[model samples]
Target: MKKNILYLSLAVIIGLLGGYLLFSINADSTNEDLTDNHNHLETTENQMWTCSMHPQIMQPEPGDCPICGMDLIPAETSAEGLAFNEIKMTENAMALANIQTTIVGSVEASDEDGIISLSGKIAENEENNAVQASYFDGRIEKLNVNYEGQKVNKGQLLATIYAPSLVAAQQELITAASLKESQPALYKAVRNKLKNWKLSDKQIDAIEASGSVRDNFPVYATVSGTVTEVIAKEGDYVKQGQPILSVSNLNSVWAEFDAYEKQISQFNKGQKIKVTTNAYPNKEFDAVISFIDPVLNNNTRTVTIRTTLNNKENLFKPGMFVTGKIEGAIHTTENSLSIPASAVLWTGERSLVYIKTNPNEAVFEMREVTLGVRNGDNFTITSGLKNGDEIVTRGTFTVDAAAQLQGKKSMMNKSGGKTMTGHEGHLGIQESNTENKPNSDLFMEMNLPVAFQIAFQAALEPYFKMVDAFVASDANQVLALAKTTLEKMKAIEESHLNKMENSHLSKSIEILDAISSNSDLKNQRDQLVVLNENIVALAMNIKTPSETLYVQKCPMANSNKGAIWLSTEKEIKNPYYGDDMLTCGSVIEEIN
Candidate 1:
């Protein structure tokens, strides 16, 4: 009985010990799992998030951006050793954008092997133009040259006239001839008077030999050329020195070209130019620059350059389009680097280009450059660049856009900061994308024609309708209204607008075209701001507005840079932010 009791006690102890050992193993496993979970929670809490467009918005946890309502992204630190204005781009991004870099190299002046292209039209050489006029007042008895383009020669019989004055003078000559021995001085004076009337010696001798006065006289052409205009018709009386025919000698013609004001220094008289015409594509004619207008045309910002081309074959006709290629001799900039115009971007008063700072990486930075005269498709950089420097010559705008989105110094944003993001579309709002837009001031005193103002005002009517659609956040309505606006803009007559005003209207129409076809509310609204800039300038310059149009401004719109829009009513209805901030603008001017 004692042995059985001890064995039962040992078995009970072994059961208790085994149970304790199992409980301890389970407790250790549970503690390890709890610690691992805590570490994972701490790691998640430590990661901060930020909005890509609004880098200023930072949060410990991922969520929608408070300012733009965009999805939060993990904030990335700027590349090490990068300047405040410089931004690094991945090789994949550069390849996708097709960004190409060109190393600055010196090029010989366009005069030496390079051709400076010029466009112009052929015109009649004014120096060779002449007016065949009547030397004496007489009625046109018969007209030999009937129509324009009739070829005539010098001293050819142009017309026959019955001149009462010349007949009376002829009779005096006849009478004076008879009494030559008694009145030799009178006879000599009468002959000299006939000579003064442009009478040839042979005709005078015949009159003397006939001993009779002829009533009708023959009129001859003074110059040989094609008749451009028949000034006097048959049976019409003309006064002395009155044009009977407008003649132009087509042996030579003028090739007139307009040189831009900026390129005035590149041209001068006596420079050789190679001329070609579309009609004669295989032929090339050589000519020398005969004249260059000293005064600049304020309207076109160009000066007239003329060259004389021999047209003996009658190849060049007046008003025919011609192209002139002059060897650039004056601006022989030896060390200056010529860059493609595509490499440059202009915003407001600043001119910019992107420089690839790192040779091995796709890092880039914005550079402000002073441009010299443009030769063909390239321009000389007077400042802000040097030889061996690498620049983005192609896909420059793409690089600028990347810089803008990455909050680096860009053509649009001189000082780097967050720009508008796509998230604005989520709330049916899209702020203006204008970068340093020009002032919307009235130039009413410009005195554009009243007809033009009326037509332009009609164009603005549909723009106001578009604004209403934008305020309602109806993308379809915006598209329809934009199309209507584009039609109105197309109908605007550009004959009355000056060069600058025409440029404004053209850009406005281009933007309208984009807005019309776009279905995205954000992009359309963003384009709308750019369109309004041109539209407002045109509205203010309206010399005679039929009705009052309000010019309203929202200083907080367009990422706090401010924007303007035209409205028929003085009440503010913000299109950038619909009901969110309906009246967030104020009228700055009443355009009329």
Candidate 2:
């Protein structure tokens, strides 16, 4: 009975072992079949592969993109031969980047020479401006030109005045006329006095012949002009040399411009300006710069630049608003290539542009460029491009996206951020002039985030602390701390770094390496700048700090908000120097 029981157990064990082997084989076969099916489906599907980060790279096989070495994604082919790496963006990314696109026509430059924009205003010509004054004390009996902006011709009667002085002068002229044969010298003196009172020769002769005292006398205009002022009206009294009316010539007009401090260097006397008026669009008048005010007008904070225009048709009246372009020929450097201003992407220090090659092909590579003076809409391409090299005048941002997809070095990722191994010296990474200067201990730092701080502190704290010691003028501590810090920061974390491949932390590590290797700093003076910059970057990832003011959400102390200054912190001002909250301020003020 014992033998039978043992045999049964052995048999059951053998059967169980055989069943397990069979199940394992079947599972292995199923897995192989699934893998094969996946490969077959990938091959069967008509999917074009391209790099997500470097769109310029494309391959038929399922492999990494050559340029960036990132895994390939499907490319969206279009009829125009443009394969849009269509990104299905979340609502958040759209709002953050302010991404908007419109179907626009190809931008073309106008053939007309560049328009010179000048800020100016209407002014009366000095030669045409006149003030009408009475030669003798008189009372105005009638006014023909009674109000401002009234037009009058030369020698036109403007008013009639009844003056006692004029009546006495006329009587004296009459007496002189009667005694001319007996007292010729006295008669001549009396006639001259009447003439001095603005009595014309004909009027004087008539007054002498009539022998009656005329109380009212007509005042005639000395010159043709528009009436700018009327000092005396009908039945008003006027004193000698008192202004009766003021007039200005309307045949010509002056357009005065306020030249800003920067534009003054471009202007010169006699420069021709093409003037136009919204009142008359068809007509364009040529004007010459007649005067440039020697002193800047303190009220407007600008210098007056005057130009005269011919107004024969009287179209340009005084106080008529006008605008015009002044065309001035400027010399440029020989052999300098000019590109559309839209081509250059300005990123603070490094300005970049994309050169379009392979016009017929679906692909165009990005080439970094340097720029020179901007002449109107066209910029002079100093280096990194040749003439006739088709550049992306429009849709550059789109092309840059393709570059990033290709896993190539780009402006944002290459200059200020981490780059691939071979792209070391391609970026301008030396300490900024502000950082290089030996300055005070108090440094204005950029606010960064906590995560960035931690990562950076791990690699840079030692070097930074040593630099701080050096700043305190402790030479021995500086030397000791600097040595340890540099070593620890430089210690390669290849294994750990590999785990964080393609992460922001990985890129930040590259930035750290470059900064540590950079020998531009005389000492560790620029560590504060780096720390502040790092802090600001980290701050971007987290929610910005906020405070409550009257139940409304407001930015926290030392934060930026548009126009509204509300703070819970004391002693901290906004970037625009607005008032701080009671809660905002320095916890500990540093001694300078």
CA RMSD per model (angstroms):
15.2, 19.9
lDDT of 1 by residue, 109-135 (tens): 333445677778899999999998888
lDDT of residue 128 for candidate 1: 94
TM-score on alpha carbons, each prediction: 0.49, 0.43
Q: Quantify all predictions' global Cα lDDT against the true fold.
A: 0.75, 0.53
How many clashing residue pairs appear in each of the predictions shown?
2, 26
Q: On a 0 to 100 scale, what is the lDDT of residue 573 in model 2?
A: 35
- Tell me the tens digit of each residue's lDDT in model 2 across 269-367: 888887777678788878888888889744234577888887777777665656756775333445667676556555333566655444443344456
Worst 10 residues of 2 by lDDT: 424-433
Write down the worst ten-residue block by lDDT for model 1.
Answer: 422-431
Candidate 1 error regions (>4 Å): 1-121, 146-148, 205-216, 234-236, 256-273, 287-307, 320-335, 342-368, 385-592
